[model samples]
Target: MSAQESCLSLIKYFLFVFNLFFFVLGSLIFCFGIWILIDKTSFVSFVGLSFLPLQIWSKVLAVSGILTMGLALLGCVGALKELRCLLSLYFGMLLLLFATQITLGILISTQRVRVERSVQDIVKKTIQNYHADPEDTVAEESWDYVQFQLRCCGWHSPQDWFQVLILRGNESEAHRVPCSCYNSSSANDSAVFDKMIFPQLSRLSPLARPGPSTDLCVVSAKSHIYREGCAQSLQKWLHNNLISIVGVCLGISLFELGFMTLSIFLCRNLDYVYDRLARYR
Candidate 1:
């Protein structure tokens, strides 16, 4: 065997190893994606709450990992079979997937931003009304009614109230309504009042119940703040992760295209060498 034969053998072995590595990696990533889609609640409870600003990072990472594994598997198959058609199909699928993700990410980000703005406005109006006439009997009464409903629903303290309040209006004044103010026996009046104003106040509850460290007894702007912050945080978190995943997918697709081109060049060179050697013989 000549030096050229040795080089060809080495190239073949390398492609075989690459194919196996990518096949396993792709399988694992596909499994992980299935897990994410299946146990979404578990993912939200464990990873979502822990990584506040980066909550969506895990999902994006999972997506990118899966896409990369897929591309690698395709490239390996194409190389092993010496099939140009397979290589072309692989590149096409990779590009299509990246484009689809980019489009979806843009749409979701836009919708989320709109929702955050609308929620913020409702919070602002409620706060403005509360503070504009803190001393007025009607205003105080309305504020008390809102606070009572929040507590009944589950808010426990001024701080909890505050979180909800700030979520509505970041700059709104903090009004503390004592628990004594709520009359459970007067269910009719409470129900009517809650129907009128508490809807906005209630909108600000966090997705997760704050731990024991959170003050459950207080009702203040903090509740509003937590609620608003969560909305804003969620949007930011999603955008960041989506951008990363899309970027990675684009990069991997380009890499696969490059590899396919290189493989074609190698095949052509091998064919030319074989033809020339046969003619000389």
Candidate 2:
């Protein structure tokens, strides 16, 4: 084949491979959205506690994934078959997707503070209602599960629970902290501001047996409790994963841009290729 033919062939195959990747990514994202929507676990409810828009986000993911997969199928078929009409369609869809991404990025950046405040308010409300129950209501149960999973206390610290009914000497679940906050291990657990739990942590009294779901514990020392707050733990985790997160975003952006470029190049050259073939015919 001529040099021009070879270049065209390379573009076609590269686009096919890239669209295959897009199909896989889109399928995975679509499945994740479905999982979040149908989730019966404490995880989604726990997330819902702080972010009320979690459901909307899931829907967006589903729609975005569908659009991506659809576009990828179009791209793959167009590149492989060298169909100008399909290539044109693929290019237009990619342009639309790129514009939507830019719009979303701008909106998120501009409204970030408001979003953060909303999340903070919701988290505070959730903290105020947390009873460390695994079967109480969805919100309460989610908070308990998050504490257990993250191995952290309240939103900011253990003191964030001091305003609860039990803390004010009213009849409630626990007096000091939720049982979820009680560390099961006896290692170097206490931070400078952490509330430690007593090694002999148990039910409020010997006569009081552990309930089927919730545990009321009498904490004497703050050392046995998870001193760090969930907020701090999450922040640290995000910080640790920031590089990977940014890298993924950049990679995705580059891939999409390349797809657009490849489609445009193929669309512009197909006319010439057909003209040459016509002369030979």
lDDT of 1 at 8: 54
Off by over 4 Å in 1: 48-70, 88-258, 270-281
Candidate 1: C-alpha lDDT = 0.49
Identify the runs in model 2 with alpha carbons over 4 angstroms from their true place.
24-68, 106-111, 129-150, 164-180, 186-223
Instruction: Give the number of the best model, judged by TM-score.
Output: 2
Residues 172-230 of candidate 2 have per-residue lDDT tens digits of 43447666676767544443113212221222234445554353343522547888998
Q: Candidate 1 on 132-218: residue-level lDDT in tens?
A: 442332332343444343333222223333334423434545554333233435443444334423332332235544322211132
The Cα local distance difference test for each model comes to 0.49, 0.71
What is candidate 1's TM-score against the reference? 0.39
Candidate 2's TM-score reads 0.64
How many residue pairs clash (N, CA or C atoms closer than 3 angstroms) in each of the candidate models, in the order given?
Answer: 30, 9
Give TM-scores for every candidate, taking all chains together and pairing residue i with residue i.
0.39, 0.64
What are the clashing pairs of model 2? 195-222, 196-221, 196-222, 196-223, 196-224, 197-222, 197-223, 197-224, 197-225
